[model samples]
Target: MRIVIVDDDPLVRMGLKAILQSEEGWTVVAEAGDGSAAVAEVRRASPDVVLMDVRMPGMDGLEATRLIVDSGSPAKVLVLTTFEVDEYVFEAMRSGAAGFVLKRVPPPELIEAVRVVATGESLLFPASTRAVIERFSEAGGYELPDLTEREQDVLRELARGHSNQEIAGHLYVSVETVKSHVASILTKLGVRDRTQAVIVAYESGFVRPGDAAEL
Candidate 1:
């Protein structure tokens, strides 16, 4: 995979380059020191993925992410952050980042995260789920979508990380019914998957990040 590294810290950029170089099937296409530079490199290099630092001197990662997505750039962004707070996590997701990892993450996990994102799977790291929970908890109460009571129940169960069978059993409904509800939930939320739906749920201010006590 062709990848670009973007960070103000030369040490971090160099370290990432070394690790990426050691991995097979990966190449460091370009490096940038700021968000604007990152965007320009993305347009020029057309790398498959961009490893971007969340905090930058100008055009922070969130704005840069918005610009990249809005520009229809093909490169997927993987934000690197130092914070575990809900604010940063939710902002990154809302800004159209494919995923993010803490800067202190192990080398192996970082490689896997980039690989997963490049392959188009949303990274739902434990920290990510915690951010989502905080988003829901702060909303006073969960935002109710346009669904029946049963459907809402299924969605909540889903946000809690329940499987279809588990949700069915919890609600005393059949597996098929749970599946149908999940489909309906996705439709009403206009999301492509449960992950995006979860993001939307928090972004819409319907669920506060702190509201999650379970899942």
Candidate 2:
């Protein structure tokens, strides 16, 4: 996967580039010092993934993510943040970031996160992510879409961070059936992926952080 590392700190960008380069089939196509430069680099590189730092001098990662998504770039943004409950990280999610990873994450897990987001899968950090959403997300402002009872159940399972296989086993249904429910849920919620779906569930009072055990 081609990736652009965007961070104001030169050392952080260099470190991330080194870590990503050590992985097979991953390339550091470009690097940017700040959010505005990151946007330009993304346009130039056309990378599959962007490792975005949430805070920057000029545009910031959140605005950069918004511009990239609005411009119809296919690159998936994976935000890098120091704080798990950062308000900017939540805004980044709203701007269409695929997911976020902490800067202090172990190299293996960080590499895996990049791969997962690059493959068009949402990376939900169970404990910290859920806590952040629950803390910041206001309840009962927006109306939820019409979902069947089974779909609601599936959504609840999803909010609990269950994979399709796990949701299937829990619901006593086939994995294919669970996948169907997930797709339907995503469509009805008007969200990109499972992470956004779970965010909606929490924001809509459909699920609470304490309701599920952390993975």
Candidate 3:
């Protein structure tokens, strides 16, 4: 996979580039020290993924991510953050980031996270999602006014990180049914991917963070 690494710290960018390049079939096409540079590199390189730091001197990753996605770049932005509950990380997700990885993550896990994101096979939020929502969400009790009850069920299942197959089985519906529900949820929420949609679920309290295990 072709990738871009973005961080304000040169050392952080170096370390991430080295770790990512160690994997076979992966290439670090470019590196950037901040969000504007990151966006430029992404345009020039057109990488499959961008490992983006949330904090930077200018244009922060959140805005860069918005600009990239809005410009119709196919590159997936996988956030690099030290804290999972960072308000910026939440904002990045809402800006259309594919997912995130903690900076202190083991090399193998970080590599795997990138691979998962690159393949477009999954949304990578884990149990840390709960902490992020609870710590950063501005409000609760928001309703899914546009979704049907069944679409709401599918959205909650999405919060659990279930695949379409899993959600279909759980809801006693076909995978196609789950896919349609997911598409509708995305449309109603006005987001790009399930990760963004699920963030909305959490922020809206439509799927409370604590409800993950039970749902």
Candidate 4:
């Protein structure tokens, strides 16, 4: 996978590069020190995934993520944050980031996160992610846009952080069928990935935090 590393901290960038590049199939295509630079580098490199730091000197990752998504770039943004429960991370997700991960996560997990995001799957920390989204979303919930009954079912399972195969089992559908439904959900919701779909599920009250608590 081609990748871009974006962080204000030089040491953090170096460390992440070392770990990610250690994988034979991955390449660090570019590096940027802040959000604006990240945007420029991402546009230039067109990497498959961008490891973006949430807080930076000038433009923050939240806005950078928004710009990247709005600009129709295909690269997925996987936010890198120091705090798992950060509001910035939540906002970044709404801005169309694929997911967020704590900076202190183990090397193997972090690498797996990139792989997941690169594949267009959402990476949820499960506990902390629910906290951030629930804490920040409106309490009363927003009215859901028109979704088919099957799509709604697929989304509720998605909000629970189930893998495609697991959701397939629950719904008694083929894995490819679940994937088709997920793609349709993303398109209908006008969101980039599963992370944003989960946010919509919670905010729409289609799936309550307690409903997904087990995940």
Q: Provide the TM-score for each candidate, comma-separated.
A: 0.72, 0.91, 0.87, 0.94
Q: Can you tell me which runs of candidate 2 are displaced by over 4 Å?
A: 213-215
Tens-place lDDT digits, model 4, residues 1-215: 99999999999999999999999899999999988999999999999999999899999888888898988999999999888677788899889988888899999999898988888654466567677787787646677778899988899888777788888989999999989999999898877789888898887878776787654
Error of 3 at 167 (Å): 2.0
In candidate 2, what are the lDDT values of residues 102-188, reduced to their tens digit?
999999989988987876544456566666666777777667899999999998887676677778888899988988888999999
Q: Per-residue alpha-carbon lDDT of model 3 for 13-68, expressed as tens digits?
A: 88988999999999999999889999999999999999999889978899999999
**C-alpha lDDT (0 to 100) for residue 77 of candidate 4:** 91
Clashes of 4: 0
Q: What's the count of clashing pairs in each model shown? A: 14, 0, 0, 0
What lDDT would candidate 4 get against the real structure? Answer: 0.86
How far out, in Å, is residue 152 in model 2?
1.0
In angstroms, give how far residue 33 of model 4 lies from its true place.
Answer: 0.6
Query: Number of the top candidate by lDDT?
Result: 4
109, model 2: CA deviation in Å? Answer: 1.2
User: After TM-score superposition, what is the CA distance of residue 64 in candidate 2 from its true location, in Å?
Assistant: 0.8
**Any residue pairs clashing in model 4, and if so which?**
none
